[model samples]
Target chain A: MSAAARRGVLPGFGLSTGFTVLYLCLVVLVPLSAVALRSSSLGWQEAWKVVASPRALASYRLSFGASLLAAAANVVFGGLVAWVLARYRFPGRAFVDALVDLPFALPTAVSGIALTAVYGPTGFIGRHLEAAGVRVAFSPLGVTLALTFIGLPFVIRTLQPVLEDLDPEVEEAAAVLGASRWETFRHVLLPALVPAATTGFALAFARGLGEYGSIVFISGNMPMRTEIAPLLVMTRLEQFDYAGAAALATVLLLASFVLLLTINRLQAWTRTRAGAA
Target chain B: MSIVVREVEKAFDATPVLRGVSLEIPDGELVALLGPSGCGKTTLLRIIAGLESADAGEVRHDGEDVSARSARERNVGVVFQHYALFRHMTVEENVAFALRVRRRPRAQVAARVAELLRLVQLEGLKGRYPQQLSGGQRQRVALARALATEPRILLLDEPFGALDARVRQELRRWLRRLHDELHVTSVFVTHDQEEAFEVADRVVLMNAGRVEQVGTPAQVFEEPASAFVMRFLGAVNAFKGWVEGDRAFVSGLDLELVAPASAAHRARAHVFVRPHELDVHRAPVPGSFAANVDRVLPLGAAVRIELSAPGFGGMVEAELDVRRSEALALAPGDAVHLSPRRVRVFPSREDELDSLTASGL
Candidate 1:
């Protein structure tokens, strides 16, 4: 048989690939192209003026900086939560596991409202912190708090299954060989977990970078201080500055794609290492 | 060195898995805990290895109580039925794991691991992972790993039970040689009587969470302690009868009492004789008992002739050599005379009804 005949039955390959390419053109590539086309209608000098403005630059710093902060925080604490949920059989474990998926299921607007009620100065936890003189809402810190809240499930869900799939027999064997608990986790468990943890971190980061609805109510979107990129794009659109809005959106979109691509590369690399081992 | 287990008892929920099992194994002796499934043999082995806790017993190593010690602290090596070799590590790395975990010197570990590979006769295969090896090779690697720790006692749970028939026999012989070379106080658990008899110096037959008999292989196979052991070893012709004075009356059968005079006074008794012990001949031998061949089986060198006779309700098996078989012209319908040279008679285990599960009746 010829090579074409040999390749006749790759299951769902043609249909799924066709669907993926069309969906990307409609939802991702076409929209990105439209954003680029609209941004290009502005003269280069004018586009530079809109993008490099001190207000725009400050939004860049806060948005990217706060998202990084949130993603970093999630990588550590989210991992702890995932490990606990995966390894232990505590009372109300089901409830706690369900709570990890709350961010995925609940509307971002509802989460924003709930978080504002709880963390706003007049709200329950806010009052206690206010007495301690630590202001949270309407600050960049509050933007980070919102992003962390929405991004946590990405990290935990990605990691929990990987940790759970790892066999405890490996650990038992290690212990029987005279290795202590710390050494076993380091030598055996951690090597297997590295890939999953990295994937989780990348997911949380990408999600935080594009987050808008959840942070808007809590951030108090002040220009040059608390305004983030997504909020800035909305402000330009509301003012009918289409060129400026499109330019900013295009930049954010490109940054997010690059970050996600890099993460995907790392994930592929990790999977290869796991398979090789 | 020497391992002593005393009053070992364990219970899972309300069901007792082990009931007061006791044994003393001398240094360099390879003893086998031999029994059928759920006989508490594996449980006893785990208890000695410190992988499991005994509820009411003590396991001592060199006269020191190590019952409460953790598996890691006990410094005993164990080989599981599945080998349980780490899939991620090469043969050398797996064998070296115990020494590495104990934080031995790197140079010494390398040398010792090399020595162990040679000892288990897998020198060139050290670089391969467990999944890359066959079942027999994996078991050998497991044995090598267990020895790598320089453990005083090695516990193997059905180590060769997973292999094919030919491989199982080959490994048993190899294990006997390995035990002789290592001289560790090794305790292996197995249900296959053939494996136990072949590899172990002392065989402990367990039944229903208790040690039924403990002796050399020949002793246990030849002189069983109870009906369970006797039936488990091989087929034995038996009769239930009542004893009166110096004679025993076998119900529904006529035979002179051959049991001890002490057993002659017992109200009820069970008389047993092995199949191969009965002598069968074609012509009417003057002193031989009378019978007819009910069935015949040619089992390689010997022909097993199952006989039925008048006044005896059950069939009795007698093994004859090919020469004797030809002389007798043995067939299913032929008349024959069977003379049993040996018999064992014991008092009825009627009281065992109350503790049915424990007595293994």
Candidate 2:
């Protein structure tokens, strides 16, 4: 009805958004555009050559592939953890709930050392796995393990509120209508959880895609296999090949931006269609 | 199908909710469990539907014990106070839920869904989800979904409790007609006396987790079983009184009576007078107490007059015909005389009057 639909959200119009835009430009836009501008010096063909080399493609495989696998794994276990913390009461539940966010608070380098010591071949759980001939530390699997650790809190934080808000009466109604347990879950509970679960999955996946520090100790920086895109970026920066590193960083930046925009659209769509919490 | 509940007892954290309650519901009759809030009416309905289990006792469907069965196995359709329709599903999908879960033929599910939507007069809105509909419409959808499998018994827990007054009145009539058409053995829980009396074939009055009285609407309304029933059914003016040696003396109103031998002695007593039971006369008649008119309020066809005798405990309320109000021509501060046509005397433990007022239900 009015041109300024967002006018009532806060008192000021020009002052609020103008200040916000200036802060965002200084904090994010200027640095990100500097990378894009620097990357243009190599020209498109030379940049493609650097990005499409066999070793570069292999790192991309480990980066995108392991991140996807880690996110898929987090969704299942994180959903269960959220359900338990939200719906049940047990001894030490509060402690367990607070522990879910430990990865977010701890320094990344500290966690990297701690994770390597725990999952190394000579470590406790690692020795048992070594007997089963499964190597986790210093492998792509280890990279995935690190991503899963960092990405878990996003999934749990997103799904927990949605689970808490679910109406138990819906399940009761389904049961009284002659639905078995599996039928009730499939038809009622799963459909209700889908939108929230998708949002959680996207958030965790995007987080996993950009993870660094901890992955270096676990992945061992193998040039053709376990090496990830961020490590390769570090490798070029250490060698002072600034333009080459900027091009790869720009690729990662665009991917993260596209994911963030998709998540935004998804949230707006869900709020309209399913009344998502 | 008929339902029989025998000595059912339920408790939450050792606090008794339903205490050894028993009931009998005849086949194909719509019965209402009516009481104030927290009176265990809904708990009894849940136990009957097999949604909740009793701590001790049994529920029977058609004389067969179903106490051990789950709600899904009992075939009793339940509608909650809030319509529990799946928000993600369309109206047609919600109505067809039970049939599809049972793996019925696809064509049969579609046909039954259509028929139910038609019965509820919501065929046009079948494609819309539950969130898009109005409150009355959503409740109608819930009703249609509950009736999808043609359940042998229907249990509704305050089905229209959340609706506004006008919508509640319309739904009450529609439910009565639908029950008449289907003739399924039905039980509904309600705190509203009017809704129960209008829609139910029989009414079961419960209080403090026990069945106080059960009878047809006219029987219970015309003849209440106890002091609680009388107070719960209508507006009453309770006066402090005492009973001694087969005689009861009521304070304030200057009245006394030799009641039954059961009330020969009591710690405290009460004399209850319903609003309609009081007779307000313009002239001072013999055997009537003198009172002063405090206020006059017109209630549609009837006019209510509030009067206060010089020594009365509280103001007395009397309902009179509109014509009689015009005849008496009473106003505030006007002198009047009033007497009760009927009164009930109940012996109680000491301080019962204060407790009754405190427990304003």
Candidate 3:
């Protein structure tokens, strides 16, 4: 077929392509490049020195570390929640399923306050944990907890459909072929679910990295201890330290972008592993 | 091994799927459970394979009871209609799965897999994934995987149903040949009568979750036990009337259809005349019914002529060779005489009692 005939079949391709490029440039590309331009006002050496400061490096460690830890924990618990919702039926099952998305619907600052109230030194369950010598509300652990709460919806939403779409016949085939129940799960079911689970993990991890509103109230913001990267950028901006703020923001942006790019490459590999299984 | 099922019953969520089904298969026989959808053929197969437990039944293999055994313990191989081959695994790995699960030596697994790939004529595609292969190739891989452990019994549920017609025909012949060579007791479920007859030594016809008849293909087709069986193996003309003694009186036509010796006296009767059994002629003959030709369909090997008899509510079909049709010069609106060479008499079904709705043409 000629190009015009082919194009006629799907009439709005050029319109959609132009609209997508224009919208993406306006919303995302321009803002990201503006941040880069702002950081370049301080020369490369000056920006590098600002990002390499002890306070900035400490904040990076806490922000990235807590986000990584929280996302890993979410994969395990979120996967369990998704499987239960997808595979089982009980009284109030629908209510439990709806409850999983509460984190997404709640305002992030409200989540921060709510989590602080629940995990503060004198709160319910927190008093018992405090007596057991585990301080939570004003520690780095609190920041991880806040990130975990906000990141859970991403994993559960991504994984629920994948778990529900799995064919029960494949499991039966494995059983009749003399595989044990555990064998069927480990060999057949796990392989089919891995790609979707990986995708969910990546989304949750990325969300956790950019998290700020929920962590401020929980994390005490102690320099070189519990302070996170986004809080450092905000503090620099508040103090009229524009160059310092730009440097910190640029470092964080690069780290998130590189993490997302690597994750996409890994997802492509897992997708091939999980197809049709 | 010989297998016997005694009074199997199953219900899904208070809905009865199988009601008191039972059967027996001698060793080395390839049997088919043939029926339409929802006839409990697949459910029965699952019960026999130990993948499903009957609400009430006892399944015995080689005179040993294994009703309580799990599917993994029963050691029966099953293939599904959709070729449930693992998508992530290569053909070689899929075939080797069962042996590997059993912790067989690596060398033995490899050798057995190679042999099975050869059996299915898919050795050349051993390294290919299930998605990379065609439907026929994937199903062949499923078969090879099911055969890996050499289970005493093999059960297949509509194994070739997902393939195209041409490929289904080829696989049907291939499965029959494989059974002949191995002589392993096998049971396959199918909705296709032709495939069942072609592959199985004995055909068990089922309806409404119960076995209607069990016999060789020739016996079931030639001597149907019930009117339902006769109607199911269709393309035959049914003439409804009444049976008295050894003769059936078709109300519209003056001809008297001779009833079989096994016929029973009934208020409403049906005489089944296959298309090939009706001999068409140009001249009016004694014991022949007069009919007007409605339409003629050329079916390659044989020509099928449809006739609407005067006073009859439904059309009667007659099939003859190409030469016979040409000689008679049959056409639309032509007057023709038909004499049935053979007919089977059975009580007409409830709907067939009023001939208008029987054909549904």
Candidate 1 lDDT score relative to the true structure: 0.83
Q: For candidate 1, list the clashing residue pairs, or say none.
A: none
Q: Residue A211 CA error for candidate 3 (Å)?
A: 0.7
TM-score of model 3 (CA atoms): 0.94
Tell me which of candidates 1 and 3 scores higher on lDDT: 3
Docking class of 3: medium
DockQ, every prediction: 0.30, 0.70, 0.74
Q: Taking the tens digit of each residue's C-alpha lDDT, what string does model 2 give over A104-135?
A: 99877777788889889998788888889999
Candidate 3: deviation at residue B242, Å? 1.8
Candidate 3 per-residue lDDT, tens place, A1-277, comes to 6646767889877788789999999999998888888888999888988899999999999989998888889889998999899999999998998899999999999999988888899988678889999999989999999999999999999989988988888888999998998999888888877887788888888888889899999897899998999999999999998877888898999999999899888888877765543
lDDT of prediction 2:
0.85
TM-score attained by model 2? 0.94
Interface RMSD of candidate number 2: 1.5
